[model samples]
Target: MALSLDTIGPDTKNTAKGRLEPAMPPENRLEMPTQSLGRWSASQERKPVVDRSRWRTYLARLFVFGGGLILTGYGTYEMYQVVSVSRTTVLQWLLVALFTVNFSWIAVAFTSALLGFFALLSQSRGRGPLPTTLSCRTAIVMPVYNEQTSRTYAALEAIHESVEATGLGAHFDYFILSDTTDPEAWIAEERAFLALRQRLGPQARFFYRHREKNHHRKAGNIADFVMRWGGHYEHMLVLDADSLMTGECIVRLAAAMEADPDAGIIQSLPLIINRNTLFARLQQFAARVTGPVIAMGLSVWMGRDGNYWGHNAIIRTRAFADQAGLPDLKGRPPFGGHILSHDFVEAALLRRAGWDVYMLADLDGSYEESPPSLIDLSARDRRWCQGNLQHMRVIGAKGLKLPTRQHFATGIMSYLASPFWLFQLIVGIALVLQTTYIRPEYFARDFRLYPIWPRFDPERALALFALTMGILLAPKIFGTLLMLLRGHERRASGGGIRVVLSSLIEIILSALLAPILMLIQSGSVFQILLGRDTGWQPQRRDDGSIPLRDIVRRHRWHTVLGLLSGISAFMIATSLFLWMSPTILGLLLAIPLSWLSGQLGAGLALKRLGLLRTPEEFRPPAIAIRANELQQRNATFGYDDQDGLLSLYCDPELRERHVEMLSPTSRRKRGEIETDRALAEAKLGDAETIEDVLAWLKPKERIAILKDPALLTRLVGLKSGTSAIKAAE
Candidate 1:
């Protein structure tokens, strides 16, 4: 909370406060000294990294499973009766009954499935020998644009040290891809980069390149590198400005890739370990604890052609180059010139070309930072949502095959899952109608000997119920088992039995929060689909948490609905008295859900009570901190200092105006362009020589101006000094 200042100030000042890495180039170019892919004599399809069966077989199974689920759902829904509301007594009861049985199955099963998947992955981690052979050259690209050079390099240094420990450090190179425009910061980056290279020596490579004209945002930044130096390396591992990974995991991924030659990509599921904010911590914990099973199930299904998040992933460079050229969707924001969300598209493209993309859930030592607040994550999601929606264009693209279709569907699912929440509202209304109106048989005179049960057919009910259980609950059940088997439930989780209990509580709380998020996400999706534009807005990177007021304000609608549901349940269940009170009381559960959207969640509770501390387990190594520049070096004319931070000793526009002030030749033109400050700052009467003009300035500044001699040569003052005297005559 105390560190929130610099990240939240006015945009201009925030930019100013962060020290910029020194200038490398205005035009960003990613050039490496290594040989191109075309230059290599080795087969482009060589299997140096991944074992073929593990990669390819996984891909085949995932598609079959996902495709089967989609097909089954559509088939079952089509066969079911389409209800037309009619006042007929039996028909209305049937409609309400149908809604209760089917809808609950879908909702409950989905939750169960999520839990089961994590269990499966935890189990997988304990059993398998992770791929460890190091045969591929992987370039870890860290793309930075006006970020803190010290912290960025520190994180990179931490990773570099981790990498050396793996003994495969020679296989990986670090690229500090600078996109900063500030001359001083640019210079700082250059100096830091050089320092890092010196420390890393030959095994660890450091590259510094700049782009003067930034066009395509982050995607284009990487694309530029692909075009320039992409051919030199076999694969590229991407990290954001704030991303960090352990060296051992890096080697493991490479080993996995080498062990399986067919693997086109390996996506490392990142854990957020540094976040202290409420919004992020919730996301971080959910991702860390709840994540493994889902990732495991996903890994189980998606052997190859899995999701490719923009960061913490390794890509086969040659295959990517040959197949990953993303066609610009012609239009405005959301559906823009360059693909904003190009990772999925690229993955799909690679798969279409018969390459395998794998999601490695078992790997660790990879870490990523999170947005400190809700508004921040939402802002980031807005861009992603729009970009994924654009992938709809690629779904129909001629050659992509079935895997691409499924991948695109997965992308849409990222935001579209919210719409399904609307179904719950419909089901809840049906629950009210059925309970209140359809009186239980013999409710008036229930004999002690036998009570009549509400009737629905056993076979139809059982079939639908089985499918629902398999799809939803199975994943969660599997996850729990995985953790137990892997021994992580006892080892990794600091809370012994207490941690498992906490996780269960977290899951239940998260489930209620889901509906509320569903509402928000659904609306956000609609806005994008309707052509609303989002931006490359920076996410909040501070440690300060979300406020409770924000939660209440944002999710109040859920609270209102919850109260209404509770009330409606009571009125219906009154006939059954306290027997039905629990169902009705579920409405009061909304209060906790609403609070979760605020600071009352475990994230904030942990920070306050120091209960769920993530520990200071994550930080960059000392070498990285020392190697990165704290003070920016300024350019002192002559040789443009590679290590110098660039500060404008003179603005060309300002100098040009001064030139006009010196001349009688362009006096009218000069006055038109000059600002009041420049005019006020201007001194008209000078002793006339360059030396005389230089006398008015401070020693360092004056010498700086003189150091660039051509500046004196081209000044309008000298050009028109003789002209001014002639004109006076």
Candidate 2:
């Protein structure tokens, strides 16, 4: 597993004329391993065997799932009995069906949480010792889109330093895989990378590669890395731009992968961190307290048939390449083309090939950031909604394990349940309107003991409602109690009283926010159904406060709808109005709610009051602290505001590095016009100075000029007062 530093060096060479030349062919210049490296050894192959332990796991899952189904059935029957006590009409039956579907969703979550709670209670708190040495070469890959260059490289540097501290640095290599589209971002990434390498010294095993075309976005970025350089490593630990992991966690994952030859992927549960906005902090706290129990429960039942979250996980590189080559779905965008949610599908494919996918839920020090605002979260969720819905096409694919299919179903339901709940609410309102305004059938074709009345048994309905609320709230109660019982966690989360109070505040806020999310998700589902695609967009990770006007513009419709609904409900019945108050209030206050969600002052106030405090917040981890420090240090002028053309014109070293990083352009067919290059060349010929060319060309045109060798050479010469026409020729 010893890594050789001989092959790792700067890719720039100086020619006799002092012009920079690419040291290697463009295909091999981006720090990729040579193609002569062998694939994973045969001994690493996973063998499928019928282990009796799988049966036990299945039985446990069956028991938990079966119990949930049974409970849901009884609840549905009780509701049906109450509805029938008045009158069983078509509308009533539809209400019953909607109620059953929506209730079942919660029922499954309740059961899963119940199992997770018990699992947490039974498990030992102590982490097992890590192996002193590792025998496999692992690559830590962080895939970046148009993300902040400083933050990404800073996080990587922190992780590298942490791993080196563990005294096993040579066995692992770090990669920053960039698929950035913006020319400014591309340049920024290269600058940051070179700086990071220099800071870490030449012996440090850090490499970077930028792709010309994004292809399938994040999934494609990783795939390109695998196809080109995956052969050199036994394992690859994939990470997102916002991901940060401790050295100990990284080492343990690698050691665990080496120890278990049959395992294909081992996922670590990543908690949210570095959040200051009220909404972000709330999400962070919930993930800290409730995420582990839920994750552990899934792990307990999933055993060998587990899921991958795409990042913060270690995987058997060969198994992934062999089994998880993603296919373009049948047709175009949205549900077709490239798979958006590739992680789940990859996990399923690995399991189909008999490779075990596991979740190490107990592993700590894995962290990620949340969206800074509710609006930002909605944007991210829209993409996720489309991705999850796209799973409908893959769920029935042949050879998938039953548990894998279940995982797919669970993901699909996560988005679908929002719309289902919205539909149920609409149906209930319609039924109430019909009962109040429309005439009910006094008699039916069938014989009846008495005339049918479209009225529900209030007492029975109240009891059923109470039961549903209890089940829905049980998980939070369980999580709270568990945290209280654990002395370390309890103290870390302020006192028990503060924890309970924070939980209560969180619950109230969640209740207020739930309806807003439901409406937003419903709209997203409708949009997706109508063939509107959500393209890949970078998430907003920093907690800068959102403008009030922007919040109002986004939520104006919600407020109007809330007013109308409240008026209608009150006109129908006082009981209906009272029942719908929570929803109405949330909707009516949507703008303010969203505005406050992104407010830093409010979040800080809560922090100062010792509310919503997580263990990480109270005592920050070393890796997190180091990452923050590096981020502050690495902050520089934003790429977008600076002139891309002038940047290269000013710095000779940067210009050379930029040229070395550009992928060699493909040869054009005869008579095929390079429109961008043609326009860029024309602009360069007309310009007298760098400022003239910068003013004449747009962002895309400028990027084109930089990418083309001839165009860039001409632009550089013109900046030095040379003849642009001769340089172009």
Q: What's the TM-score of every candidate structure?
A: 0.65, 0.92
Segments in model 1 whose C-alpha atoms lie over 4 Å from true places:
1-136, 180-204, 258-261, 423-474, 546-729
lDDT of each: 0.55, 0.81
- What lDDT does candidate 1 reach at residue 720? 23
lDDT of 2 by residue, 643-724 (tens): 5565566555667777777665422345767777678878899988665787789777777777776677787776433343
Evaluated against the true structure, the overall lDDT of model 2 is: 0.81
User: Candidate 2: where is the Cα deviation over 4 Å?
Assistant: 1-46, 49-52, 446-450, 636-641, 665-672, 720-729
Q: Model 1, 390-449: lDDT tens per residue?
A: 877667765554656877876776676665545534554554466457665554263534
Q: Between which residue pairs do clashes occur in model 2? A: none
Candidate 1 deviation (Cα RMSD): 11.6
